[model samples]
Target: MDNLVKKVKEGIWSGRTDHLENKESFRYHQIVELAQLDTLDTEGKACVIIGFESDEGVRRNKGQIGAAKAPNELRSELAKLPWHVSSEKYVVDIGTIDCTGNDLEKAQQQLGDVVNQVLTKKMTPIILGGGHETAYGHYLGVRNYIGKAAKLGIINIDAHFDLRPYDEQPSSGTMFRQILEQDENSSYFVLGIQRYGNTQALFDKADELGVIYICEEDMHGEQLVQVNKAIEEFFQNNDFIMLTLCTDVLNAAFAPGVSASSPFGLSPNTVRSIIRIVSSNEKTLSFDISEVNPLLDENNRTVKLGAYLVNEAITSFLN
Candidate 1:
């Protein structure tokens, strides 16, 4: 694990300032850094951000290849944002887990170890992703920390169900399926599933696996009341909740940097509301935003949106 992980480079915080008298003063880069993932001091902190800098699973899944570049891009953007809150305790940059020689499984295992380390200390783990594959790795860590029988529920905001079979080897498209196959106790509820994005076989697989999902239309229409009710019930049944947001779930105009952008996708406003609702609940444990591919992006829109979502979640978790 040590071989795969590296401390966040010092220069990532270059834009920091000490002008405390300024009304909109502090920024993210000003937050403290941890020497290592396990060395974090969670005394006055909301969460620690850890990056997974690998996209090999995307390559295996035959998606766009550039998602591997997302984590650093996210950090570069997140570091520049001003921290509006007035507290000394802030998020810690716990560095990243890089996949060397395209060894995806080892990287995910390393990630799982890091997530377990974070959980035991009672601090939230905010995993900045390499791909949707990060979701599976994040799940392994959560399951490891809470146990397979811990009544953990996963809330995924994605355009596709990502429950494709992994008979051979798992890839970005088969993470949720991998999770379900590994743990029958898994309860997953996917929101923002695009009707056009997934095939009928995948939908059948979701049903076969007893997965809960709401298509994009169902999430936006009057059915939202029922959707919230379902989500509330799911939350009540679970001891802990893990959240994952796939950038491709947003409309292309809002998140063009994703591996696959949706023309008819959920609005960022709607997604933020969901994040607020989910994070506000004390049961939510860990979170990650995945599938940001800047090589395909216009400007830095997707990564900025990813930072905003992380900030929103942290603020909700803190307050």
Candidate 2:
């Protein structure tokens, strides 16, 4: 047994497994330059990747362990993605977080720790996977760090407003609800929300909370103007912006691995255009892509696509 474990560690795995053969390996790939311990005094740039798999406990039971596997899978795929930006010049530390526990509060607290650590280093947190519910913790960290210094803006691309009543405690489907409760004055906008999934109650809540939602039918047919206008408005008010891309906002054909696969979503080109526009803006402090469940994916396509989106955003910064 010891020999088998040693061979797996030295051969198949990178010798960083949690146990002998039961746990997943670390999900980080430091393609860029590695920093020395002495450099701790300096503020370094980095993009943090995190995975949270307690979907069942969080009340988002779409992809099970697939959510937990996203950060590592996306990193593996990113290693192969051809970045349009030069590797050496663009030095970004890849900090991958592991959220293996089943407690939602505990998982969220752990995520909050990573967020604080990244912002402290003057690095933007480009997190991946876990669940949309993780956004609450992310926002908590942002509020704690920024602390009245900068007005915050939230740009969410999703198929649902996720503004369900704060009654059921808050899950992946209620992150924005918690977000609004925390900072109702913060500028928040939702793009590509399917008209069918959102309840009238949510629309009313959004209106009351000053949250903007651009529905799918409206965006695809006649609401393009509104979508563009909302983007402009969000930036005009808040200097610090966090953009979140929920894979379910894309049509199931493009992102079938999401927890709740929806048909009426933005096209790949449209989403890319949005990302490009946002990335080009100077206000964007950080970006995140969630709901990339590898288990539901047909052939690792979702992971690859998510990686491509990240690559495009990183490249856009160069342009």
Candidate 3:
């Protein structure tokens, strides 16, 4: 753990510190506990924030590379949000795992170890990511905690199938294919897939892998009822579920700071509903948000939006 994660800097959590004793006056920075992974206490009813600071996978996949900066930027934005959960529940930041010198594989393994430890402490892991590759490490931790016999369902809110082949090397685009082909106990259900976002070969791969998915165009209004039904069925089938969001799944108009922009992606509200539903479920074990690039953002729009969405998940999990 020492080789992988560095404790978050104190300055990263700074924000308005009003009425130190009043719960109502609290902002996230005021209430969040900062701890080193090794010294963390045995605490339950808490959500631990782990940052995956790596974009090597995105670079390998031939996409923009600024997602490495997302973890702290998202933290800065989250620092100002009002704290609404009960006082007994906690939010803890355990710092970040950096992908130094293109060692994404090592960083990912390190992330998996930290995540496993967080779960072992009986806390929910809310991972802020470097790229969509974060899902694989997050998956590694969850599967480690639950054991091989337990069925794990991965609920990804994204525009691409991410089932691309990784024969040469694993990139951000090949995580799901790696998991489905390697772990029979794990299953995947993706929402907000775009018709043009993936190649026909990827679609065929998704089918071959028996993936359950809902296209972006069919995720709104009356159609949400059926979507909810599918989500419920997925929850019932798996022993545990892990939720991941790739910001690129949102319409480029709403989220422009991602590796891949989706002009016809799902709206923020639509994505929020799915996060709320999945995070609130008892079967759900962890949550991760990926591909938020501050370097490409419009006046921090995507970073702030990502923070709000993360708040939604944390609030739902604690409440």
Backbone clashes in each candidate structure, one number apiece? 0, 1, 0
| Overall lDDT per candidate, in order of appearance | 0.85, 0.65, 0.93
List where candidate 3 sits over 4 angstroms from the true fold: none
| Top-down lDDT ranking | 3, 1, 2
Considering only N, C-alpha and C atoms within 3 Å, which residue pairs clash in candidate 3? none
Task: Write candidate 2's Cα lDDT for 1-319 as tens digits.
Answer: 1110011111211223333332132222323333322242333334444344445423443334456667667666765543344333343433444455546766676666656655666756666666777677677667767776678898888888878765745567778877777774577888887878777887888898888777777766455666777788888998678788888888888888877788777887778878887877877766777878888997887888888887766666544
Model 2 gets an lDDT of: 0.65
lDDT of 1 by residue, 98-164 (tens): 8877788888888998888889888888899988899888988889999867888999999999988
The CA lDDT at 15 in model 3 is 90
Question: For residue 161, what is the lDDT in candidate 3?
Answer: 94
Off by over 4 Å in 2: 1-30, 33-65, 91-95, 221-226
lDDT of 3 by residue, 15-105 (tens): 9887989998999999899987777777569999999998999999999999999999999999999999999998999999888898888
Q: Deviation in angstroms for 151 in model 1?
A: 0.8
